[model samples]
Target: MIELTLIGIGTGNPDHLTLQAVAAMRAADLILIPHKGADKDDLAGLRRAICDRYLGASTRVALFDMPQRDPGDPDYHHRVNRWHDRIAAIWQDRIAAELPLLSGKVALLVWGDPSLYDSTLRIAGRLELPLTTRVIPGITAIQALCAAHAIPLNRIGAPVQITTGRQLRDHGWPEAADTIVVMLDGESSFQTLRPEGVQIWWGAYLGMAEELLDHGPLPDAAPRIVATRAAARAAHGWIMDIYLLRRDRDQQAGRA
Candidate 1:
């Protein structure tokens, strides 16, 4: 049986590895790390660092190129579907080549909690092997953002909506929530929203020693965040950011 474990290593933090994740890494017959090419070599390097720090000395480690997303396709969802299929094929090929007799256990180092905005599960689903999968939860950017800003995700008797940057731009504020946490945002979607009295706590490179954070009223802070995010992304060649926005009807009644 090909047992696959999705180990959540958290966002750029080696310390985010849980005890269970460590054990899983130690038990794996093979560990796969996706290479994102030169511009994003840091991602591949981080995966290597994790493997170097963990993974029993005898365990085998494999590296595979991550397939690129096809932007020429008009249908966004269709493009993503095709991309996932390509990645699954790559994974299959690498596994067959590297571990011909592999059977016991295998794992992939996920950047964040597998259940949160990550496609590893969807890709793994395409494999026909009678494989059982396990997800080891780790801290997500949302959690790190909240902690960095000293804010509570949910306010007293209120709900928090988690969404993508695209939806925030197209649909505006979701009526379902007074608090919102946005992820997988390539653009500054918060600026599109009506910034009246909304509070924003933004974070990038969370958990890393170089983590950066900023927070203030959306109206007062959104522009700064937009410019800062742009500069940071340009400087680093890539960036991952997450933010929490809270709206309070009462002027004096905002609390983390």
Candidate 2:
């Protein structure tokens, strides 16, 4: 039986790795790192850095090219499903090649907690191999963002909604939530919202050396964030970012 361990490495910092994650990495018979093309090569490099720091000399490391999702596919869910299916197949191929017997402990370093916005768990489910899956939770970008900003995730007794940029762009603000955390947003979806009483805390490369942060009333920060995000992506060739939006009801009332 193949024991698949999905270890969360947390943002891009090796220091963010938990003791549990380190133990799992050391125990794995094979560790697979995905190459996200030349643009995002740093992603694989970071995973390698983690292994270099934590793993013994005997630990086997394998690298594979990550499949690109077809942006032309108009249906987002369908596109992602197809992409996940491709990734699962690649995992099976890599595992079989490395562990010819097909029975050993395997590990994939995940960004942030696997339970959060990441698709590692979903991709693992698509694997055809008979495997017992395990997760070693690590810090999430949301946690890092909050910690970096030194703020709480929610207001007292208020519910916080976690959503994607697509949801905010398509549905406007969620009616039930005063505080919203937006992830997987390539476009500055906060621009789609009415900025009057909303505050935003935005961070990119949260725990990395090139980390960038901006916050303030949405109206004031939106443009600056867009320009900053664009410049960062151009300089680095890739970017992963998240933002939190909180509507100030008192401020709205005062404005009215």
Candidate 3:
């Protein structure tokens, strides 16, 4: 049976790698790292760095070009499905070439926990090969964001909502929760919300050398976060960021 292990490596920080993740990397016969082009070289580079640091000498590493989603297609899910199919094809070809009989263990290093906003699992499901899969969870961006800010994820006895920037922008703050954490946000969607009683805690490139952090009331912090995000992305050519928003406790109390 072909063993496919999906390992989460945490945010960009090498130190975030768990013992289980390290063991999985060393045990694999081959590891696949996706190349996202020069603009996102750091993504692949970080994977390589981790391999160099932990993988055994007998393990081999392979790089594959990540498939780009077609922006011309307005239907997001359809575009994503096509892109994933292309990626599955690439994975099939690479495995055939690298692990001739497709009998050895292969691993893919994913960012954050595969169970979160990541699509590695869904893409793997499209592979034609018979495979046994396993997952080693890693710290997620939400964990990194909360750690960097030194804050808890939720208020006392309250629910916390995790969402994408697009969702926050399109749906507004969730009525069910006082705390909302936004990820995969390219547009600083927090700006779309009323600033009156909301506070934001934001972090970019969390756990890396170039990490940035900011926090304060939404109205006062939104513009600075936008400008800072733009500047950082220009400087590094890419950035992964997340933010947490909460309605003031007093404000909620007043409403009640």
Candidate 4:
């Protein structure tokens, strides 16, 4: 039986590792780190650094090449599903080759909580081999973004919807929630909404050294956020960001 542990390491900050995450790292027999080419090597490097900080010498660390999506595929979901299957196959092959006996624990460090926007759990489900899975939750980008900005995720009793950039652009604002926290948005999705009554709090690289933050009325902040996001992505070759939006009226009553 292969015991697969998906540990959340939080954003890019080493301090984000929880005690449970550290314990999970130390317990694993082998940990897989995915390399996303030289430009995004910092991602793989961060995982390695986490392992180096917490794992003992007995634990093994291996690097795997992260699969890239085929740009030519017109069907986004189909292409992603196929890509996931390829990744699952890679995981199976690596486990078999590295642990031929197939009795030891294997782990992968994930960004943020696996239960959130991350797809690590979904890909792990594609493993054909008999597998036991365990997840160690860590801070999410939403939480980090809120904490960095010293704002609450939702106003007192109001609901907050967490969504992606596509949803925000394709479906305008959610009716039920006064506040929306967006993740996985490469293009400043807030630009799609009317800036009249919305306030946006944005943060990139939340817990990292190169963190960037901005907030104010949507109209005033949208331009700067887009420009800053572009510059940051260009300088680092990659970026992880999240933002929270709330209608100004929602906060008029002074709710936390």
Off by over 4 Å in 4: 250-256
Residue 108, candidate 2: alpha-carbon lDDT? 95
Q: lDDT of all predictions, in order shown?
A: 0.86, 0.94, 0.93, 0.90
Task: Give model 2's TM-score versus the native structure.
Answer: 0.97
> Which candidate would rank higher by TM-score, 1 or 4?
4
Q: Between which residue pairs do clashes occur in model 3? A: none
Q: For residues 44-128, what per-residue lDDT tens digits would candidate 1 score against the true structure?
A: 8888888899866878988898878987999989999999999988887777777676566888999889999999999999976
**Across residues 7-41, which tens digit of lDDT does each residue of candidate 3 receive?**
99999789999999999999999999999999999
- From the highest lDDT down, the ranking of the candidates is 2, 3, 4, 1
Q: For each candidate, give its TM-score against the true structure.
A: 0.95, 0.97, 0.97, 0.96
Compared with the true structure, the alpha-carbon lDDT of candidate 2 equals 0.94
lDDT of 2 by residue, 8-74 (tens): 9999999999999999999999999999999998899999999999999878999999999999999
After superposition on all C-alphas, the RMSD of every candidate to the true structure, in Å, is 2.7, 1.5, 1.3, 2.7
As a TM-score, model 3 comes out at 0.97
